[model samples]
Target: MRRVALLAVAAPLLLVACSGDSDKGITVRAAQVATVSEIVDAPATVTARAMATVTSPADGRVASLLVKDGEGVNAGTVLAVVDSPSAQQRLAQARQAAAATSTGAVRIPRVNLAGTQAQTDGAAAAAFAQSQAAIAQIPDPAARARAQTQLAASRAQYAATQAQARDAVRQFDAGLAGLGTALRSLTAAQGVQAQAAVAAAQATVAALTLRSPIKGTVQLGGTSAGASGNLSDLLGSLPGGGAGAAGAAGAAGAAGGAGTPAPSAAGGAAGAATPSLITPGALVGQGTAVATIIDVSALGLQADVDETDILLVKPGVRAKVELDAVPGATYEAAVAAVDLSPTTSSRGGVSYHVRLTLGAGRDTAGAVVATPRPGMSAVAHLLVRTARDAVAVRASAVVRVGSRNAVWVVQGGTARQRYVTVGTQGEDLVAILAGVRAGERVVVTGAERVHAGQKL
Candidate 1:
């Protein structure tokens, strides 16, 4: 009775296993003889490739805030205006100095060097003629003596003339060199003054108009320390102080003062350059970073990659990114860079920030086609490993025994369990390093149900 009962249960189980159900398959073909691309998937992000910050390059009073936040701006657009009358005045003074130096009176000294040379030359000629006459009057016996004396006198006169001419020439050349030197010195001084004028003018211009250096979105920030008001007065006045003195009024005004604008171009602006995107009445100051203009044309996705998986990522490797906020949309990308250093977030968690560059794929029709903003979550699949023309089996077909993995091979109507050393694999296929060959049948569908020596 017990045997009959066992047979009854066994028969139904056998029939059920042999029936045409999904679990009935017990044969496996060779793992597809194609190259299997191994991939690693992780989260990623989209961000601008370049970002610019607009700040006060000078310190002065804010006369006008030309742009507001969230507004798009182009390069060289005036964003704000600062008052710098003092700088303008200084520039005007410098310009006046330069003009005076340029148009200054010229002085020329009178020196008759040519007349002096002519007088010396005539004296020398008369002296030569007298010496020659003396030589001709000498007798034949005293001719030698007369010739020698005349020669001496003639040489002396010639030497005096040469000396006079040399002195005149030297004086003339020296005067010319001195005049040139003086003119050059004046010119150089004027040039220095002109440069100062230009600098002052540039400073005034810069103070008058705040411009954007790049095309992007705007931002805002606080006022400068000097422009904030006197700290002592502020402290003394606190909420209330002196009656109605200018000091008291000035102190109160300073306390409630709208912060000063950036300095003249000569000096950097003390206030922030108004970003077209920012609203008015925003406080800003010198050395304060007010706005960031981001270039969003080429998008980049930043992702945190596990240290273990980072080895598989290389620059230029293909990747598929899926944003959590945008459903049914996937962006094709490539590994732009792999950050070797791990950074800790505010939460004290360490992560490697990997940057992925998006490919040239656009979705023009969808309602959500608008570009994704920063802080969006994304998943990235990176190719890690691949195998070609190698034996593979479904992950389900692999079984673990002790420390080794085993799979059941069906050959000649018998089921045999064989150990395999695995390599790379995918969702449904595992690369077989040993114990299996291409085109050989293995249990794929009923991997969990099959055992060694089990009847077919």
Candidate 2:
């Protein structure tokens, strides 16, 4: 009887100890009302608002470089001068030809049909008069009769000659008209040729002097081709058309090689040379880029978003950007554009390019921060949705039970599993629409350590 009483007392004490241990082992926090936002994160690259590339207008030796790299310049600034003796000579010749054409001294030989007709008429009259005199000189009685007949025949011959002279005059007039038309045509053609030559020469001369088309910093060098010791040397060394010529080879390869052929390295080299096509002394061909000018007044970010998440991104959406170069700085941004078309990777994954405009940002103390430069690596978090003043809990506190979302609620120092309907889910918090109320203590961490109806 004594042993049984002691056992019952010990069992009650052991039960109390077990309950206290369960409560001590688990962690719980009160659910709170707060705002939650859904965001999509993407890696991004910084770029300038505008970029201008200046290319060589013609094949020539660089005579002088007026601007250095990173030098600020205005539009129409003379950046470099190229010298082509051949081009200069051509221009001079063209100018002379144009001057000659503009003057009226040049004329086609004119035909005088009226003067020729007058000469023909005079000859015909003289022949007829001579024939009449010769007939009068022949006089013997029978011979006189023969002279009279001959005189009649001479008269008839003179009349026929007169008609032939009129026909010759008409033919001469028609020939003269055709000759005038030909001369006019020749004159017009000469004038057109002169004008065209002058225009072409002027263009060539202007191309020899490189000018900046935009107001920005001057980045010296020709596109992808390494700078030569001098412009002449560069031009002489590179193949005609420089690196741009490789494009044709690449195209041919694509057409004949079933798309499996790699692009020519020469083409890539040409592209790299584009920014620095012509140095102070390097030679470059026409249409080859000599420098690139970047406008940095406005900065933007370019990022590739996964195809799955692209649909949620659209213009005008608010975003937050963080630069890799400027740690601890966050810039406010907006989605400026989202590409409708997607780019496919070698692995067959598709991604769309997204552009964002960076706005002014402030530090934790509310002071303005420095603007990021182009080419900076960055990350952006775009806000997709937001829920205001919603009942929410730490994401860890919510657990999936079967098909329903549930949370472990602590009431009377014990955990109770309750099903909750979730709304928008954020990175760290989830909005609750049902089952859980604000200020309710929920098991956030160590929830797996406790079961339903267990002490928390």
Candidate 3:
């Protein structure tokens, strides 16, 4: 029954870890009652906390190289200088424009128009009291009542008239102030635009002195190391590489808009062979790769899980990772976050992105192993669901026949097809909810190829 709940969230793919043995090309194993767990196998990539790439802000030649590749430098350290005359000229022009729009000498006018509604309300009340007093001598009840009602109606009309007048006066005053407000708004807008242009020009000029966005060891002219994110992080977060522990990547990005491109682009820089143009007096273009800083203090993992299985994988779920480069080693990690947006591939398959904090790694003998380098290919086996004491069979025995799952059961030397409802699926075993019973010999391998009523 517990396995039934996992059917909707479990992905069709079986990646559960288990042990199995096959006797022949067509092996049949007796269905046994065992525990099985559903797994969401996702491909993951090692990502750094931050890999800030520094680039030239303008098209100019390198005037000086302050830091060499592979040197440890502090944040805001000047790495290189590009002497761009155009950048300086733009700064001068922006300053002039800003000075022209300064409104210090001109005053912003104030407007106040007192309304007559209050005075009219008081006068109308006094006049109504005088009318009532004048009518009190009419002792005839019916005539007096009619006279009072008439006075009330007249008073109401006078009240409405005064309200209308007040509204008119308000509209007139607003019209008079419209020109003043327009003038103030125009002046403010001009000043804001001028200041923004000046700031941009100043940023460009300052970028000429390329500064290290973070405190880290620099990598000389080599392939621009990609930032600390997997392809999934690149798609989902798109900034600061993938977010990790503190002191990882914050410094790699910017010193409050110093004109350096976001660190994400650093991972897309030139090759390992330092560009010959990086030396002093070499010409370079705008946004040219200058250097990179890799923060090794922290690392993260980005995994892509199929849309069908993502729901079961949540924050804090544990995962065992296997890297292609580090064979026979398993790493421990836990889910940090799951991306709300889905990443659709060209093949039309949709998957949700997940981020995890990388932990330690162990080898086949349970000995500690070295950590994997960033951008390493890895497979994450996320334990999403588990079923215990269920009717289990070899995973290979189950075959998808159109909309249903079935197995080829060998009964008295004859093989027959039996449809079954499955629960949690594992690598070597699958938990069956119904149809095939325990001790039934089912074809584990070649189940898809076998026909019903075939002689075994």
- Best-to-worst ranking by lDDT: 3, 2, 1
Model 3: which residue pairs collide? 16-427, 48-228, 69-220, 221-274, 222-271, 222-272, 223-271, 223-272, 226-267
Per-residue lDDT over 1-456 for candidate 1, one digit per residue giving the tens place of the 0 to 100 score: 000000111111122222112546664544434445677776665666555454443233456777666677886667666454433444455455446545653222335544544553554344344333323322121322434453565355445545644554565566644344433333333333243333323333343455665666655432232223333532343223334212111211111111122222210112333323223433333323444555555677777766656777788888766778776776778887888888764356666777877754334353335476644667877766767665666677788889999988777766789999887767666778888876566677777778777754
User: Which candidate has the highest lDDT of all?
Assistant: 3
TM-score, every prediction: 0.49, 0.54, 0.56
Two-way lDDT contest, 1 vs 2, winner:
2
Residue 267: error of model 3 in Å?
12
Kindly report the root-mean-square deviation of model 2 from the true structure over all alpha carbons. Answer: 26.5
lDDT of candidate 1 at residue 81, scale 0 to 100 = 60
Question: Please, what are the lDDT tens digits per residue for candidate 2 over residues 1-456?
Answer: 000000111122222211234445655767767777778888777776665565554456678988888888876777777775544555566567556656753364455644544553453344334333322322112332453454455445545544554455465476633454444334443443444344434444555566665666666753334334355664554334333211111111111000001111110112233335455766655444566565666778887777777887889988888888776778898998888878874357888878888887667777888887666678888886677777777787888889989999878987889999997677677889999987778877766676888855
What lDDT tens digits, residue by residue, belong to model 3 across residues 140-193?
Answer: 223335545665665555555555545544665767434444334434433443
Candidate 2 matches the true fold with a TM-score of: 0.54
> What's the true lDDT of residue 209 in model 3?
75
